[model samples]
Target chain A: MKPQSMGQAVLIGLALIYLASLYFMSSPVWMGFTINALIVAVVALAWNITGGFGGMASFGHAAMYGTGAYASAILQVQYGINPWIAFGAGIVAGAAMGAFIGALAFRYGLKGSYFALVTLAFAEVLRICASSFAITGGGSGLQLRLEPGLSTLQFNDRSVVYTILLVIVALVMALTAWLKYSRFGAYLIAVRENEDAARALGIDTYRIKVKAMAISGAFAGLAGVLYLQVWLFIDSAVVYGSAISIEALIGPIIGGAGTVWGPLIGTLGLHLLGEGAKHLLHNAPGLNFVLYAVVLICALRFLPQGLMGLAARIGTFRKKEDDNA
Target chain B: MLEVRNLSKSFGGLKAVSDASLDVPEGGIVGLLGPNGAGKTTCFTMIAGFTRPNEGTVRFMGQDVTGLPPHRICALGMIRTFQIVQPFAGLTVQENIAVGAYLHHHDRTEAMAVARQVGKRLGMGAMLDRPASSLTIAGRKRLELARALATGAKLLLLDEVMAGLIPSEVSEIVGIIRQIRDEGHTFLMIEHVMQAVMSLAETAYVLNHGKMIAHGTPKELVQDPAVVEAYLGHGAAARLQEGHHA
Candidate 1:
C-alpha cells in the first residue's frame, strides 16, 4: 500500500486505537456488532465503484457475496481447507463470477435498466442454484464449529471477529482512497460520463468497467467471508438473497455515490435507520424493509447527491468564507 | 498531406457522397464550400474516420487509413471538431483541452502546458478555469479550436467553425487559422462564410447534391458558372453580371 496521507494516517490511527479500546474497554457483543457494520460498510464502498462511478448499477452483488459465504463454508466443511485460504479462494471466485456476468451483459449490449435486470437475474439464478446443489448442503446449510484460534478464522471470543472486521474495513477504505487519484479511477469516470468520448481518447471503456465490477465483487466476497466467520453458519437464504444486494446498495447511496466517504455515511445512516426500525417496530416483521424503502426514497429526493456531496458543498462554502475573511 | 479517392457513402438509397476525391497538400487551408444537403459533412466525416466510406480510400501522409477508428486516425495527427460544438459540460475549459493534450502526453503538467499555450493561442486564456457549459457560443467555439489545436494534429478537419460567430469574430478566427497555417499546420475547413473562405482558402471545392461540382482556386471557384448558379440563384448571378457591367 502507498504511504497513507496525513489525514488518512490520523484517521487509521484513531480507528486502530478505537479497535484496541474495544478489547480493553467495550463489551465483546458491542464490538461484534460494530465489526458487522464495518464489514457492511466495506462491501457498500466497493459496490459504489461499479454502480456509482462506473454507472453500471447492479442488483446482484449478493450473488458474489453469497458465493464467498458458501465457498468458504463448503471449503471448511467439506474440503478440510484452512478458512484463511478459503477466504482468498472465495474472493477470487467472486471476482471471476463478476467478470463473467459483466462480460456477458456487456457482450449482449445490455445497459442501464437492462443491465440491472441482468444482475438481478444472476442473483436469482445463484440463489436457486445454491438451493438445488446438494454438495453445498442445499437448504440444510453449513455451520462451522467455533474453534478458538487465529489460524481457524474462528474464535470463541467475539472481540477477535470485531478486530478482524475493523482491519478489513480499514483495508477496503484505503484501497478506495488509492483508486480515487489513480488513472483507473479517472478512466472509469470517463467511461461513465461518455463511452464514445472515452473510446475516442483511447480508453478501453469495456475493460475498465469489467475491472471495476470484478473489484467490487471481490470486496463483497471478502465481506461474505467475514460474515460467515462471525455467524458460523451459511445458508442459501443468507448468502444468495436479493435483500443482501439491496442492503449493499443502500449504504453507498446514503453516503454518496462516487466519493470514498459516501458509502461510509450511507452505511452508518442505513444501519441507524435499520436499528431504529427494529426498536420501534419490533412486533411488525416487515416494517424494517418499509423503513428502508422510506429512508432510500427520502435520500433520493432530498439528498440526491448523498451526504458526501452536502459535506463537499459545505467545505467549499466554508473555504470561500475563509478566503473572504 | 492527405488524399481521398473515390469516396462514396450512401444512407439507404440516398447518396451522401458520390465518388468524391480530393488531394490536399501540406501547409494550406483548403475550403470545402457547399450549399446545405451538399454532403460536405459526409466527406469530412469519411476523411476524419468517423464513418467508413462505402467504397473509397483515405490516404493520410500516404498511408491507407480508410476504415481505421476515429481515435487512431486522431493519434496519427488528424483531428476534427463538430459543426455543433460539444464542450464536455462537466469539465472545466482547461480540463477539456487537457483531454485533447492527453493524446500526446500523459503527464498532467505537460498537458497543462499544452493547454495553456493552446488556450492563449485561441484567446481563451482567461476562461481556462471556467466550466465549458457556462461559456458563450463564441467561447465554446474557442474551446473547440483550442481542443483541436492541443491534440498536436498536423491536419485539422474543421466543420462550420464560423457558423455562429459575428463578422469580426469570423475575421479573427480566420486570422488565427492563417497564423496556425504559418506555423506549419494544414487545414480542411467546411465553411459557409464565403467572404472568410474567399480570403483564407487558397483552394476551394464546391459540392452540390452529393456530387463534386467544381474544384479550383478561390478566384476561379467564385467565377465558375455552376458555383455561382448553385450559391446564388440563376437570377442573382444575372443581377451580379448587370451590376458588374454598370
Candidate 2:
C-alpha cells in the first residue's frame, strides 16, 4: 500500500482495536458510556461526509436522526412492526429525510452558514412536529418491550450492543477509507474546495452533495435507532434535540474534520475528558459543560485542524528525523 | 467548433457586453482582444454557461447550447479556465487535475493516469504530488490549463491563463498552448498580452466598449484604425498610417 493508505489502515486498525476492547470491560456503567460515545461517533462520521468532506457544515443534523427514531418508534408502538424491519425502515426514513432537506437547501443555493442554519431549522421544526403530533406519541415517548433477546436487537448484557456498534463503526470507517480513494470523494472534495472549478470540470456538485447528505443521514438515523433500542424509549428531545446536532458536529471537528478516523478518535477523547471532568468535580450539575466549553474553545483556537492534524504533523516530523539519521 | 451570435449581457444599468459575436473553427487558435472592461470575460462566461446572455445564441459543434450549465457544456466537449485560478487548496496537484480527468474516466486509477499524463504534457510533472496551494502564480496558471486539458474537452475558452505570469513564464505557456493546438484542440483565448496573442492566434477579434470593432488577422488588426484607437488615443490610427510607432 501507498503511505496514504498505510496511514488510514493504521488509524482504522487502532480504532477497531480500541472499540473491540470495550466488549471485554466488565463495568456496566463504563460499558454504557462507551456504547453511547461510540453511537455518537457514528453520527459524527455521517456528518463528516457533507460537513467535513463536502464542506457543507450542518448545525441541525438531528433532523435525520430524529426522523429515524420517530419512524421506528411509531412503527413498533403503533403498527406492530418487527424491530428488525423497523430498523431497515428507519434507516430509509433517515435517507429520505436527508434527500428532502438537501434538495431543498442546495436547489436554493444555500451554502456555508446559510446551509448550516437551514439544517438546524429543519431539525427544530422536526422536533416541534414530533412533540405535537399524535402519531409520534405526542408529549409522551415510545418505549420498547424489555425483551432480552437477539430477535428484538436488545440485550440485558451491554456487550452485545457494544459489539453491534463496533461492526457499524468499522463498516463506516471502511466506507470513509473507500471515499479517500474514490472518484466521488475527489469530486466532493473539489466541490468543497472550489464549487466553480468543480462545476467547470463537469461535476454536478448538487447531485454529489445530496447523495452525501443521504448517506450521512442514513448513519445518523441508524445512530438514533440504536439509541432508541438500547434505552427502550425515545422522545422528541431525546432524538431530535439540538444537543444531538451539536454532538454530531463536535466529535468530528475535534478529532479531524475530513479524515477517516477523526470522528471516532475525537469522540472517544471528548467522552473521556467529559467523564473525567464529571468525576473530578464530584459530578457537578453543569460544571463539566463549563470545562467542556473551555476545552472546545481552545481546540478551535489553537488546533484549528484538530487532533488528526497534530498527528500528521508529528508523523512528518518523525519521517524527517529518520531521513536525517 | 464554437459560435456566438449577438450575445449581450447587462448587470442592471451597466452593459457589460452588447451584441458581441465570435466564431472559433475546429483546431484553430482565436483571440479576443480588448481593454480591461471590454467584456471579454463576460463573453467567455456566457459561452461556457456561467452566465446567461440577455440576447443571442451560443452554438457549440452545431448544437444550440446557449444557457446550458457549465458541466453540461463541458460534457459536450468544451471547457473554460478562470482569470483567477482556483485550485483545490486541500488537494495535491495530481488530485486537483484528477477531478477534471474523472469526467471521462470513472475509474480512479485511470483518472489518475490521465491527470499524470496531462501534468507531464503541461510541464508540471515533478510537482504533481505537491499541494495545489503551494504553487506559484505561473504554476497555478499551468495547473488551470492542465486541469482543463485533462477533462478531454476539444474546445477551451481560456480567460487569461497568462494574466499574472512573467515574460519567460508566459513564453513557456505560449509554447505549451501551441503544442496543444497542434494536437487538434480549439482555443478561444481572451488575452491582454498582445505579443503572445499576435504570435499564437491566426484569427483575432477586437472588442471595444462591449462591442466588436474589428475582426481580422493579427497583422490586419494592428493596422485597423478602430483597433488602434481602442488601444492608443484617437489620432494614433492616422499616426500608424504614417509609419509612426508607439
Candidate 3:
C-alpha cells in the first residue's frame, strides 16, 4: 500500500476511536466542556486558513463571528425565519464580510501589523454598531426563543449539541486536511513564506489570500451560529469581543499554527488547562485568564514552533533511531 | 521572445534605469553587463513586472504587458529569479520547486513529479526533501533556477545567478544554462561574472550610469572603448587596449 493511503487509513481509525470515546462519555458537564472546546477549535481552524497559511494575521475575526451570530439571531427573533435558514444566512453574511475586509486590505497593501489593526478596528466598529442597533437588542444583547427542536437547532439533550459540535469540527478538520495537501494550499504556504517569490512563480497571491479569508470567515460564522443555538443568547460583548479573537489566536499558537491537527489539540489543551485552573483556584473570577497568559508566554518562549514542531522532531528522532538500528 | 523598449525609472532623485532598451530573440542567450548601480536589476525588474516602468513598454510574445503584475507576466510564460535567492525557507527543496510547477500542473502529484524532474536536472535530486534554508548559497541559486525552469517559462530573466559562486560552480551553472539554451529557451541574464557571460551569451548589452553604453557580441563588448571607460576609468580603456595587444 502507498504511504499516503496508509496515512489516510490511520487518520480514519483515529477519528473513529475519538468519536466512539465521545459517544460513551455520559457526564453532561464533560460533554458541555467538550462542545465548547470543539466550537473554539472550529474558529481556530478557520483562523489558521488566513493567519497561519495565508500569512495574514487578523485580530478581528470576532466581527465575522458576531455577524453570523447576530444575523441568525435577528432573522429568527424579528422575522420569524427558520433557525436553520438563518444559520445558513449567517455563514453567507460572514463570508461577505470577509470578502469585503480582504478586498480593502489587500487592495491597499495594508499588511503585517497594519492589516491586523484594520481587522481589529473592523471588529470594534461592528461591536459598537451592534451595541447601538435596536434590531440586535442593543448593548443588552439578543436572545433566541426557546423552541427546543432539531428544526430550531435548539436541543434539549446536551449530548445532541455535543454530537453536532463534533460533526462540525470534524468537517472543518477534513477541509483543513484537504487544503493542507491541495495545490492551492501550496500556493498559500508560498505566499506566507514569501509573497514576491510566489508571485514570480505565477501564484495570484491577492486572490488566494482573499479566497482563504472568505472560507475562513464562513467557518468562523458557522461556529458563531452554533454558539447561539447552544447558548440561546448572545451580546456584542460575547460575540464580537476581542476575547473571542484572543481565544482564536491562542489555540493555534499553543497547538501549532499551519498544521491540520494543531487547532484541535491546542483548543482542547487550552480549555482543559483553563478548567483545571478554575477548579483549583476555588472558582476565582479571572484566574483562568492569568493562567492562559502564562501558558501562552511559556509556549512562545520554549516551543516557538508550537507542540506540532515538537512532535515532528520526535518523529524524526524515532526515524533516525530506526535507521541506526 | 522578449522586447523591452524605452524603459525608464527613477527613485526620488536618482535615475535607476533611463531609456534602456534591449531584446532577446527566440532561442538566444542575452547577457546584461553592468557595474553596481548600473540599473541592470532595475531593468530586469521592470521587464518582469516586479516594478512598473515610468516610460516604456514591455512586449512579451507580442503583448504589451508593461504595468501587469508579476504573476500575470509569469502566466504569459516569462518568469524571473531574484538576485538574492528567495527560497520558501519553510518548505523542502522539492516543495519549493513544486510551487512553480503548480502554474501548469494543478494536480499535486503531477506538480511534485515535475518538481522532482526539475530537481534532478539541476542536481538537487538528493536534497529534494531537505529544507531550502539549509542549502548552500550555490544550492539556493540552483533552486531558484530550477523553480524558474519548472514554471515552463519561455523567456527567463535571471538576475546575477552566477554571483557569489566558486569557479567550478560557475562553470557548472554555465553548462546548465547552455544546456537550457540548447533546449530552445530564451534567457536575458544580468551577470557580473565576465567569463561565464562571455562564453554563454551570444549577445551582450552594457549599461553604465543608467544608460546603455554598448551592445555587441561579448568579445566586441569588452573591446569597446565606451564600455571599458564606464566599467574601469578614463585611462583604463587605453591600458586595456595595450594589455589586449600585449
Candidate 4:
C-alpha cells in the first residue's frame, strides 16, 4: 500500500495477472492448467525454504506430500470430516514428519548428499507403506464422497476451485516474499553457505535448518490439501509417487533456486510448455522428459541463476537508467 | 580481558597446541607471532571456540567459558575471523555485513544501517551493493573484518588479516586496527607481518612448536636468542636486526 518497495508492486502484479487470466479463460482445460500451476507454485515455494535457501537438497519431498494427501483423504473418507478440517489435519501431520526428519538428520550430522539420500529413502519407505497400509486403501487408494456443500470444500464448479487456488498461491507468494528479508532467512542463507562461518558468528545453524525444513513441510502439506479438494480422491500413485517429488523439486530449480517468485514463474512456464509439447510431439512419448532436460541443461549452462536472477539484474539496470535520466 | 589456561589440542599423535597459556589485557592490541605450523592458528581456533581444546579453559572477563559454542561466545562479546577470507559469495557486500548485524538487530532496516556504518568505517561504503564475489582479495579481507566488527563483539580475534595485503593496504589496516583498539575494543591478533605487529602490539607473545617460548614487549622479543634461532636462519643471527626493522 505504501508503494515504496518492489515487493508490494510484485505481489499486486501477480494477483492482477491471476485474476485477468481467470477472466479470459472460460474452458475447463484452462482452469485445470491454472490450478496445476498454483499447486506447483505452492510446492516450489515450500521446497525453496530448505532446498534452495537452506541448501539442503531433498529428493524425498514426496514423503511430506504423500503424508498430507493421505491425512486429508483418510480423515474425510473414514471420519466423516469435512475436507477443510482435514486439510488442517494434513498440515499438522506434515509438520510432525518434517520436524522429526529434520531433527534426526541435523542431530546426527547428516548433510549434503547423505542428507538428500536420507530424504529419498524416507520417501520410498512412505510410498511402500502407503501401498501396504489398509488405512490408506492399500494399493487400491481411497475416494472421498463428494458432499456438495460450502462447508465440505466441495463445489460443483471449476471456477470456485480456481479462485481458491489463486488466493492460496498469492498467500504463499506473500509469505515467501516476507521470508526473503527476515532474520531467520538471513540465518538460513548463512548456514547454507558456510556452517562453520555461520556458527562462528553465533548463528545456531542446526536449529535454523530444522525450522526451515518444518516450515517447508507444512507448506507442502497445504498444497496436498488443495490437491485433494480439487479431485476429491487420493491414491498412492497420485500422492506418494516419485513423480510428484520430482515435479516439486524440479519446479524450483528450473525457475530459480532461492529467489522469491521463482517457483511460481517456473511452474507456470513449464506447465505451459508441457501442454504445447503434447500437441507438437503428439507421437513422441519421451519428448516431455527431453524438453525438461533441455531446459535444465540450458538453465545450468547459460542462466545458472534462473529467470528471476535475470529479471532482478534488468530491474536494477532500469533503475540506474531512470536515475541517469 | 581474555585468558587461556593450559590450552592444548592434538591431531592424531601430533600436538598442534600444547599447554599454551596467555592473558590478553582489555582494550589493547596483543600480537601473537609464530612461524608457520607453530600452533598460532590452532590456539586462535580453540580460544574462539571453533574447536574444542583437548585440555584447556578459555576464560573471558570472569566467566569460565570452556567449550562454549562459537555463536554463544560471540554473543558474550567475542568473535574471530578466519585466516582465509570466506565471504558469502551470493550475497552483496552489505548483505554479508548484515549477516553479522543479525546477531545484534532483528530489523533489516536497523541491521543495514549498522552495516553501512561499519562499511563506511572500514572504507567499504562505496562497494556496499556489489556482490561479495566481485571484491578483490584485500576488499574481501575488509568485508570479513567489517562483518566481525558488526557483531558488536568486545574482543576481536584477527588471524593474519594483513596476510595478503599490499604495503599501503597493510598500513591502512594497521591504522584501522589501531583506531579500533583506541575505541576501547580489545584485540588478540595473530600476525606474520612483523612490521604491523611490532608497531601496533603493546605486548607480544612468541610461540614455537605449540608452546609459548617467550613473552615480552616487541623490543625484548627481538632480542630473545631462542626466538631468533627459531625464526632467523642458521648462521644468520646477525641479520635479525634487518628482519626486525624491515
Candidate 5:
C-alpha cells in the first residue's frame, strides 16, 4: 500500500505537535474538556471508516462504544483482570461486535437508510440487554476500584491520559491517511460509489465493508476505553445512549467525511463551537443547541461535501487556473 | 474462449430468456444483437455470474462458471461492463480504472500504471486526471471499456458500449475494439449500432422473444427472413440485401 509515506509522517508529526501544545494550556479544566472532545473525536474517526469511506452510514455506533466500555468495566470490576488487559479485551470485544453486526446486516443486503436503521436497532437491543444484565450492574452500571496508576490505566495527572489519548487518535489519523491512497481505500470508495460496479471490477465489497466496520469498532472501542479510564465508571444510559452515536457522526459530517483529517477536525471544531455557544449564551444553556442546529443547517446547505471537500474544490480551482496561465 | 448452452431465465414466469446460446472463439469479436427487452442484458448477467440461469451452463475458458458471484467470475478472467456505464463518479478517470486494475496488480502504484496504460490505449490519455462524473456519454463508454480492459481479463462482455454516440465516436470505438481484438482479447458485445457490429463482429447472434433466432455472419443474419421479421422488420432487410446486391 506504500502507507508509511511522507504524508503520513507529516500527519503523525503534526498530531504529536498539537498534543504537545495542548499540554501547555493553562487551565486543567480546559484540558479535561479537550480530553472529552478528543474521545468524541476518536469516535468520529471511527465513524469515518464506514460512514464516510464505505458509505455505510451507521446510526448505532454507540453499540461498539458502549460494548467496549461495558466489557472493560465488567472485566475489571467482576473478573478482577488488570485494567490495561481489560482495555485491550474491550477493544477486541467491540470489534467482534462490529463484525458480527456488519456480517448480519450486509448478509441480508441491507443498505442505505435500511442499513442505518438495522444498526440503530442493534444498539437499542444492546442497551436493553446491558441494562438488564446483573454483571453490568444493571441501570447503575459498574465502577472500577479507586486505585490510580499507570498499571490501572488511570492517571492522577490529566495531561498523562490526554497525551495517551491524543497519541492513539494520532495513530488512527495516520491509518486514515494511509486509507487515502491505499488499494483497500480504493476498493472501499468503489464500493461506496456503486457496489455492483465494484463487484464487477473484482472487489469483494462485502468483505471490505465488514473489515471497515471492524476497524471502526476498534477505534470506537478505544474511545470508550479512554472514557472509562478517565471516569472510572460506566452506565448503560451514559455509554449506550443515542447521544454518543449522534455525537460520533456529527463531526465527520461537518468536517468532511471520507477524508484523511475530516473526522478529527470536525470533532474539534464542534466542541469549539459548543464552547463558544456556552460563553455567548451563559444564561440559557439549551439555546446553544438551537444555534448548533442553525450552523449545521447552513453547513449542509452550503458545504454539502464538508470541509475537506471545500479544500479539494479550492485545490482543483488553483490547478485549473495554473493550466490556464 | 466463451460458450453458453441453453441458458434460460424467467423473471416470475415472464421468460426473459429461454434456451439462448452463443460462443466466442479465442481472440474473436462476437456480437449479441437483440432489440430492447430482448433479454440480451439478462444473458450477459447470467454469463457474468450476476444472475443464475434456470437451466443452462456457462463455460469460460473451458471451465463451468455457472451460479458463481460476479467478483469470482471476474477473478476467473471474465468481466462485464454495465449498459448504464457505472463509473465511480467521485473518482478521477485513472482512479476509476485503477479500481479494476487492482484485480491484477495489488500495489496501488502498479495498478495505477496499468490503468494509465490501458486508459491511454483506449485514447483516454487526456481524460485520465479528469473526474469520471465530468465525462460525456462517449467518454463514459470509453471509460467503461477501459475499466474492464484494465482488469487484464482475457474476455470482456460489453453491454451497449456504444449505445449513445455520434457516428464518428461509434467508428472510433469500433476501431478501438478491433485493435483490442488483435491484441488477443475475446469479446461478446451487445450493440444496437448496426454499422459497428457489421464492421467489428466476425459472428453475430440474434435474440428475439428470449430465444436465439439466428447465428451467422452479420451479413447472413441481416438476410435471414425470421431474423428480418423479428428484428429489422420486413422492408429493412430487403433494402440491406438490395444494397448488398448493388
Candidate 6:
C-alpha cells in the first residue's frame, strides 16, 4: 500500500477505537474532556493549512474562530434564523475575513514576525469590537436559547455532541491526508520552501497562500460553530481570546507541524496533560497554563520536530536492530 | 522566439543593465558573456520577468510580456534557472522535480512519473529517493536542469550552470545541453566558461559595464579587439593582436 493510504488506514482505525472507548465510558466528565480535546485537534488541523504547510504562522486564528461563532450567534439572536443556516453563514464569514487579511498582508509583502503581529492585531481588534458593540451583545455576550433537538443543533445527550465533533475531526483529517499528496499541496510546499523557485516553476504563490488561508479560516469557523452549539454561550473573551489562537497552533507544533496526524496527537497529549495537572493542583486558576508552558518548553528543547519525529526515529532504530539481528 | 529591446535597470545610482538587448531565434543556443559585474544576470532577470526593466520590452513568441510576472512568463513556455541552485531541500530528488512537473500535471501520480522520467534523463534516477540536500554540487546542478526541463520550457534561461564544475563535468553538461538543444529546446546561457559557451552557443553577446559591447559568432567574438579589450586590458588586447599577426 502507498504510505498515504497506510496513514489513512491507521487514522480510521484509531478513530474507530476512540469511538468505541467513548461509547463504553459512562462518566460525563471524561466524555466532556474528550470532546473538548477533539475540538482543539480540529482547530489545530485547520491552522496547519497556513501555519505548517504554507509556512505562514498566524497568531490570530482566534479572530477567524470568534468571527465564526459570533456570526452564527448574532444571526440566531437577532433574526431568529435557523441554527444550521447561521452555522453556514459563520463559515462564509470566516473565509471572507481570511481573504481580506491575506490580500492586505500579501499585497504589502508583510511576512515573518510582522505578519504574525498583524494577525494578532486583527484578533485583538475583533475582540474589542465584539465586546463594545451592542449588536454583539456588548461585554455581556450572547447566549443561545437551548431548544433541545438535532434540528436545533442542541441535544440533551453529551454523546451526540461528542459524535458530531468526532465526525468533524475525522473529515478534517481526511482532507489533510488528501492535501498531503495532492498537486495543490505540492504547490503550497513549494511556495513554503522557496517562493522565487515556485514562481519560476509557474506557481502563483500569492493565490496559493490566499486559498490555503481561506480553507483554514473556514475550518476554524466550523470549529467555532461547534463550540457555540455545545457550550450554548460565547463571550468575546472566551471565543476571540489570544489563548484560543495560541492553542490552535501549539497542538500542531507539539505533535509534528507538517504531518497529517500531528495536531490530533498533540492536542490529545496536551489536553490530557493539562487535565492531569489541574487535578493535581486542585483546579488552581493558572496552574494548567504553567504546566502547558513547561511541556511546550521541553517539547521544543528535546523533540523540536514533535512526537511524530520521535516516533520515526524509534521506528528507524528498531529497523536497525532487526537488521543487526 | 525571444526578444529583449532597449532594456535598462538601475539599483539607485548604479546602472546594473543599461539599454541592453538580445535575441534568441527558435531552436538556437545563445550565450551571454561578461566579466565580473557586467549585468548579464540583470538582463536575464528582466527578460524572464523576475525584474521589470526601467525602459524596455520583452517579447516572447511575438507577444509583449514585458511586465508580466515570472510565473505567467513561465506559463507562456519560458523558464529561468537560478545561479544558486535551489532544490527544495526538505524534499526528495524526485519530489523536487515533481514540484515543477506539477505545473503541467495536476495528478500527483502523473507528476511523479514525469519527475522519474526527468530524473532518469538527467542521470539522477539512482538518487530519486534521496533528499535533495544530500546531493553534491554537480548533482544539484543536474537536478536544477531537470527541474527546468520538467516545466516543459521551450526557451530556458540558464544562469551559470557550469560555474563551479570541473572540465569533465562541464563537458558532461555541454553534452547534455547539446542533446537538449538537438531535441528542439532553445537556451540562453550566462556562462563564465568560455570553452563551454564557445562550443555550445551559435551566437554570443558580450556585455561590458552594463552595455552590449559586441555580438557575433564565438570565433568572430574571440578575434574582436573590443571584446578582448573588455575582457583583458587594452595592453593585453594589443599583445594578442601582435601575436595574431605573427
TM-score pick, better of 1 and 4: 4
Chain A TM-score, each candidate: 0.89, 0.92, 0.91, 0.90, 0.90, 0.92
Instruction: Tell me the spans in candidate 5 whose CA falls farther than 4 Å from its real position.
Output: A1-21, A283-289, A314-318, A321-325, B232-246
Over A170-256, each residue of candidate 3 has an lDDT whose tens digit, in order, gives 788888888878899999999999998999999888999899889999988988898999999999999999988888888888877
Over B145-199, each residue of candidate 3 has an lDDT whose tens digit, in order, gives 9999999999999999999999999999999998888888899999999989989
**Alpha-carbon local distance difference test for all models:** 0.80, 0.88, 0.87, 0.83, 0.87, 0.87
What does the lDDT read for residue A207 in candidate 3?
Answer: 96
Docking class of 5: medium
Among all windows of 10 consecutive residues in model 3 chain A, the one with the lowest summed lDDT is A316-325
Q: Model 6, range A89-148, lDDT digits (tens) per residue?
A: 998988878877888888897888898999999999999999999999999999999799
Q: Alpha-carbon error at A102 in model 2, in Å?
A: 1.0
Task: Residues B141-214, candidate 4: write the lDDT tens digits.
Answer: 89988999899998999999999899999999999888888888999999999889889999989999999999
Docking level for model 3: medium
Q: What is the per-residue lDDT of model 1 for residues A198-306, given as tens digits with 9 covering 90 to 100?
A: 5555455667788988998889888888788888888888888887888788888876788776776577667756767777866477676788899889889997767
Q: Which one wins by DockQ: 2 or 6?
A: 2
Interface RMSD per candidate (angstroms)? 5.3, 4.5, 4.4, 5.0, 3.7, 4.9
User: Among these predicted structures, which one has the highest TM-score?
Assistant: 2
How high is the lDDT of residue A290 in model 4? 76
Error of 1 at A210 (Å): 2.8
Residue by residue across B1-246, what tens digits does model 2's lDDT show? 788999999999999999998899999999999888888989998999999999999999999999999999999999999999999999889999999999999999999999999999998998898888888899999999999999999999899878888899989999999999999899999998888999999999999889999999999988889998998978887977787544
Worst 10 residues of 6 chain A by lDDT: A316-325
C-alpha lDDT of residue B129 in model 1: 76
DockQ of 3: 0.62
> DockQ (Cα-based) per candidate?
0.29, 0.62, 0.62, 0.50, 0.59, 0.56
